[model samples]
Target chain A: MEYTYTRSVGPVIDRFFSGLADRKIQGIKGSDGKVIVPPTEYDPYTGETLSEFVDVADAGTVTTWAWVTDPRPGQPLQKPFAWALVQLDGADTAMLHAVDAGDESRMSTGMRVKVHWCDEPVADLAAIEYFEPEAS
Target chain B: MRDIAVVATAQSPAIRKEERRNEVEILMPVVHDLRKRAGLKQEDIGFTVSGSCDYLQGQAFAFVTALDAIGPWPPIDESHVEMDGAWALYEAWTRLQYGDIDTALVYSFGKSSPGDIRRILSLQLDPYYLVPLWPDTVAMAALQARALLESDGVTEKDLAEVVSRSRKNAKDNPNAQLSGDVDVDTLLKEPMYLSPLRKHDCPPITDGAAAVILAADDRARELTDRPAWIRGIDHRIEPHSLGVRNLADSPSTRTAGEKAGVGNGNVDVAELHAPFSHQEIILKRALGLGDNVNVNPSGGALASNGVMVAGLQRIIEAADRIMAGQADRAVAHATSGPALQQNLVAVLEGEK
Candidate 1:
């Protein structure tokens, strides 16, 4: 059995998805100068509308991560991977994404990772595919 | 605020699966037991409210079917919340404030064995971003656990101790699903199911139901010899996006605890609904509970967590201790949403 539902992403969210489709990530500046990726309309803490958008580097440092030994259906990867909270360069906040590190031993806090974009542009979260260890 | 008290409570023993019994069947005996304890009939209940998720049962209006347990034939003032029973009790408490009603029946049930609970819970996330990733419950919890470990300087051994203590405390709980003496050293030796979290650190998926009979003032005293009077109650929620907030701390919990007056007096006992061991540590800090306070003496969610009823069970645990003359003041906490995104705190006290 299957079911389907549809919704409008609205202006604030639409801006973020549209940017993702073009392979460019944008972070909006909050009242306190913190940059929020996958931008929100208002600051969660200050409750002020944010308008300034800054383009952040695709590569970032992993603030925290959890290794998943077994993959469940619909996850970004089929094999073992690490789900990380990555603080993209120039952004104060972090975004949640999968890290394609091969082994648990390879993943660590403060490790540098860069976004691996999908082969084709898709205006959704999957467009980012997953993050890979940054090349030295 | 009208003086509200938990006069009576009953809960089914937590089990992995009740293969033969349906939701109504699981709830009937619990409802009957509480009513009998309170010595009241269906008509005597001024209002009825319950909490349960339709997604778990895989059908819409699934809660309506459970009404059969209440025998709604003669018609009754009833309502339901698509959340944990703790929220349902909150609604009932609010209803009693109008002075039109003196008594209310609150209950909740969950049967998660029928479906893949992780997949079902995934639907609760924001559809566009978080839901598309389909991160399961444990994985989300793992994310928080890692953050807590990194920022708080807590070690894996600390998490193991919490697991060991929870199992040991659960031995006294007849309704608990997992209870016994577990060695902390052995737990640390076990492989990580989700890195930084051993299997013992997680709660057992359970099927169960619980009921509480609430009364105000004189009605409360008439129902039971000792009533667990609600001294203070408040709840709060953080942002829905996990990325937007700090995972290491529960600010919402801290706020609710302060507003609920958790620090107003000595807390003899506290029943915190921390399903994850690491979460228990975060909650203790959020509520500012000292070492003297007994936390999760009934083993808490780690021992037996009913999907929709565990939060209510925490309240019942605290109330039971109060009504039994074991404690004068206690704090009961309930959490909903992924990674403790929302929290409810209530202060229960016994009559002097």
Candidate 2:
């Protein structure tokens, strides 16, 4: 069975979706002075409303990762990939995404990766297909 | 806070699949057994509350169907939480403090076999950023496991020992679905299903239900001879996002443990709801439980994890020891959300 429903992303989420469409990554400066990608309207700690928008690099380092040897259906990658929490260059917190390194031996913590933009940009997380190893 | 105690508890045997029984079918026997032990009918109970996820049953208001087991003909005062039964028990405990309701019946059930368990769990993630990626529970857990491994220098052998010990402990628990005498060396030799995680490190996919009864003060003594009085009960949660949170440490569990006064007295036994082997390690550290504490003598969630039921089972296991006169003081811990984002801790003790 399948169903579809549409709802507004609201102000905070709307900004994220619109930014993804233009392939320009951005984060909101949290009350703690840290930038958070896919930002939340209120500070996680203090619950204060946040407004400052900050641009972040499309590249970042892997903070921690899990190697998925067997991919499940509906997952981002068909082949084996590492699910990583990458700390985007300017963002204080990491964002979850898959890294499409060919082999398990190739993936490691602290490795740098750049976002792989989708062929046809869409206003969702799928706009960035997956992260790839950064060119040294 | 008024003194409340767990007077009676019952749990169905955990199994990989209940092909013949529906969710309601799986719950009926357990609820009947619990009420029978408490010697109370639906009408006698002041309130009824349950915890279960509608997503698991694949229908809206799926929990309402399970109410049939409780015989809600007279329309019992009831509530529901889309969480593990442990949280429902927590709510019931709080409601008992109002002094109007002296007794409450709590239950939770789940059948992870009927659906794509992993994919279905992904729906719990943030809709805008995480849900679209479809990260399974195991994969998400592996991220925390990996982080724990790197930060603490824990080896796969250490993880294997936890799995071996959990399964070995299950040998004594009839409700546990998985149990046996196993060697850590043999387990360590097994292939990795997810890098840094062996198959044993993950919990079994289980279908089961559990029911518990809570009574306040005099009513508790009337229901059970040795009531497991709740000395302290509290819960805390971390931010929803996994990115900013420290995967290596469970600050939520720590805070909840502190609030529950786990360190105030000696804990004879501790029941922790850790679905993964490494998570048990994290919980132990968070609770500040020493080697002196007997942890998960019932095999815990690693032996039989029925998504919404396991957490409550932890409380029952701890309370069971107290009622049996095996332990005087004990602690029960429950967790919800991925990577131990939310934690509930309850300290229980027998009559002083």
Candidate 3:
């Protein structure tokens, strides 16, 4: 028997993805003033609930990366790609995403990349297709 | 820290297809029987935990529907593992260590016959490299069996012997799905489902649910004069990739067994979760059990392999022996992931 799962996105996450739909990155600022990437509902270090959302720039520097010589099912990339931990321009921590760098030699830590949004945003993680290196 | 014991265990009859009812309906009777036999009410349970795979149910959050059987009107502290019931028991044991909850209920249900069991297991592999080829569970176990045969000089006859013994043992267990007296010679002559493995060598496709109740210290004594005290429990995981580790040897099981003190003294009874015949031999070697250990006195997984639930049933069966004064100390084991990539072992004992 086949089964399907319909997950209900909570309000905090819904707003985060809605922001992504507008090609904008949002982060939740904790009481400590540290901005969290992917906009967590609660502060991990303080254990306090967060409500303040701030827009962060999409352009970011790659912090660390692992090349996905072969991509897996449900991943953002269908072809050879690099999975980079990117610290978005105004965020304090890194978020994982596919890096479309054409080849392995072109991808490196500290390289600057810009978000390449999907043609149509569906309020899902895949709305951001992948990050590609900025044109030299 | 408080001592916890598995007081009661009950399971639905294993079947190829339980079409008349869904998971909740299938589980209600088992839950009722477990509560009834343990002489306890639903309200008496301090915590509940379950083990199941969303993949097996063909739906995510399958356990959510199953919660209906427990009747959550009062609300209970609960958690779930995307693993076998044995791991749920491990979590319950850990909870008991805190002395917060005295009584906990652990259960698991699976409908292995619903879809292609082998095909579904391929998802457990590293999704990127190995899964595209769709290597099923049987083929992977076959690889391990092949390694055992080539390296250790284990013969086909030995595999058949496990099947024969398991079926004979199952004759006494009404809950067993497959059981009968079959000659090892006849089993060896049967056509190979996977080469070097006969039809009986592999577990029959079974759909079933099982539940076990754990009571700690005073509650255990109040529930039964003979409580099967858990002496030790531990589990470990190996890397997901098959190429990264040795197939013939289960290092995870070895590590868990040592931590659980399987060979601390004498183990009168052993219940090892071996879905295939050769896995039993591999587990025996891994646990370092000699000829003295009475292995799978309750027929083990060869008689009824109920996916996520079978492993916990092993622990329950071993505990039953101690509770009934049939044995003093015993070892029970559970395995998960592809080719036994994860393992849990526990030691149970009765009052001296």
TM-score, each model?
A: 0.97, 0.98, 0.72
Q: Could you give candidate 2's per-residue lDDT for residues B253-284 as a string of tens digits?
A: 99999989999999999999999899999999
Interface RMSD of 3: 13.9
Best by TM-score: 2
Kindly indicate the candidate among 2 and 3 with the higher DockQ: 2
lDDT of 2 by residue, A1-136 (tens): 6568777878887888788999988899999899997688888888999888899999999999999989988788999999999999989999999999989999999999999999897987889999999988
lDDT at residue B233 of model 1 (Cα atoms): 92
Model 1, residue B351: displacement in angstroms?
A: 1.1
Residue by residue across B153-257, what tens digits does model 3's lDDT show? 799899999999999999988888888999998987787665446668788888889899999988999988798999999998875645335667898899999
Q: Report the lDDT tens digits of candidate 1 across residue range B1-352.
A: 8999999999999989889998889988999999999999989999999999999989999999988768786899999999999999999999998899899999999998889998999999888878888888898899899989999679888888888999999999999999999898998889999987888888999999999999999999998999999999999999877788789999999999999999999999999999999999999999999999999999999999999999999999999999999999999999999999999999999989
Q: What is the full ranking by TM-score, best candidate first?
A: 2, 1, 3
Candidate 3 deviant stretches above 4 angstroms: A1-136
lDDT of 3: 0.82
Binned by DockQ into CAPRI classes (incorrect, acceptable, medium, high), candidate 2 is high
